[model samples]
Target: MALLHKAHITPTKLELLAAWLPARPWYAGDGPLTRVAAARFDDPAGEVGVETLLVRAGEGPVLHVPVTYRGAPLDGAEEHLIGVTEHSVLGKRWVYDGTADPVYVSTLVEVIRTAGNEAVEEFEVDGGRVSREVDLKLTGSGAEVAPATEITGHRDGDPTVISTATVTLNVNRVPLIVVDPADKGVLSACWTGQETPAVLVHLR
Candidate 1:
């Protein structure tokens, strides 16, 4: 389960993204961004913050961005740093591109390999617990495991593919309205306002 605390964050997520998104080679928008939905993945050790955000700029395509927050810098991952932000509850945080974090990469791969879904989230507010429904639903295929040698992103395709030594993971960076199932191992999601589930990742 993913637990969320009512804590403050400096340079809020949107503010940080505004400055960061425009620099990405895959970003195709130049307008104001609207957050569509978000979901979290639990860190069993309870040290890192893992979350995925779905946002759109005006009428543009919805972008899927997964980020990982850590209290300390990740060694050899300086190139993937998304910038740092202070958390009210957790002091200084070192935010990194989720693809470069082993925890995030493993969890994501595990989710797709085990036919798992998004973790249930609960919000703690005013000493009361409120169940938060995930606006997006995710599912992974139960495939054989293999140690990932390296994971790299490919932007030349329609649905960007994150490739590893043993598998090719396709991510729907720009989501489509239509729903279609893949013939191979995949990671898919369905949103509340969409008529069909979008295949977010495919493993083969």
Candidate 2:
């Protein structure tokens, strides 16, 4: 389960993405971005928050952005750092590109290899717990894979490539809404305007 706080955050996520998106070579946007939906994957250790935001920049196509939130900086990931933000309840958080984060990579590997679903989210409101409705639903196709210990990530234009010695995951930064029948052993998503699952990542 993913615990979400109702507390405020300075320089909201959109603001941070807006600033970072323009610098990425694979990103295509000309104006302000609007949140379309979001998906979350739980970290087994519960120390990291892994989230993927689907946002549209003005009239542009929806973009896939996966980010990880941690209490401290991820060593040797200075280039992937999105920005540090102050969370009212969690104090300070270090945000980084999920592709470069080991926790995100591990959880994603678990999801794909186990044919798993996204996270169960709950919001702490008024000292009470309320289930947070997830607008996006993503599933992974099962595969036999070895656990990943090291994560190396790079971008091939639009797709972010996460690789280990035994496996390679290609994450589509700009996902298409259409589905392909032959795409197996992949992670797919189905959301509000998109009922048919779109291939989000291909593992090889």
Candidate 3:
């Protein structure tokens, strides 16, 4: 499988984002992404991993996303984001865009389900990679989650590392869901009523 060099920052991942982010409905398309930064989360596997990033496109507000990459490309992924380009450290390549891919999503959900659910940990690496993870149990919850395929990756000057994992689970007891007030989505409170609640993750 084509993999990115851990110790170096490369344009391969950036190019992948160049094609994927604008395709999302949430993307605010103003112009090219002027600046891009990354932060790694924790990953037990030393291979591919997870990352959080701020992609600043032109003068528009930057878009924040958590991405998980895996082994090379899977079949038809070449049309998406794959292979090595002129700007990478390993000279080899890594899978760039995998969010839309089911394999990637499933892996993330699995990791979350198995991870420890006590608190949320947020950290930022030297190269600008910011990450967050939590641990929660989703046994009775009706929602389905995916396992983490490749762990998160980060670059701190000469050394690149996958920080840690952030797991999220649901435990029913007055739920609090955050939404954009600009939208007409219903709002709920976590302290709605004192009752034994069951928490569940709603994965749409």
TM-score per candidate, chains pooled? 0.86, 0.95, 0.43
- Model 2 lDDT per residue over 1-204, tens place: 888888899979999999988888888867889998897999878899999788989888888888999999999999999999999999999999898998888888889889999898998777889998899898988888887768754654578888887689888988866777666668898888888888888888
- For model 3, residues 1-204, the per-residue Cα lDDT tens digits are 112233554555566667666765556647777544344444445455554444667777545444555545555455445334442333444555434333433443553445422223444456554434322211222223344444343221111112223422221112324433232111111211212222222222
Output the lDDT of residue 102, model 3: 37
Over the stretch 4-98, how does candidate 1's per-residue lDDT look in tens digits? Answer: 87789997888777887777767776689889888888777888888878888777788888889999999988877888999898878888767
Decreasing lDDT order of the candidates: 2, 1, 3
lDDT of 2: 0.86
Q: What is the C-alpha RMSD of each candidate to the true structure, in Å?
A: 2.5, 1.4, 12.8
How many clashes does each candidate structure show, in the order listed?
1, 0, 33
lDDT of each: 0.76, 0.86, 0.40
Ten consecutive residues with minimal summed lDDT in candidate 1? 149-158
Candidate 3 achieves a global lDDT of 0.40
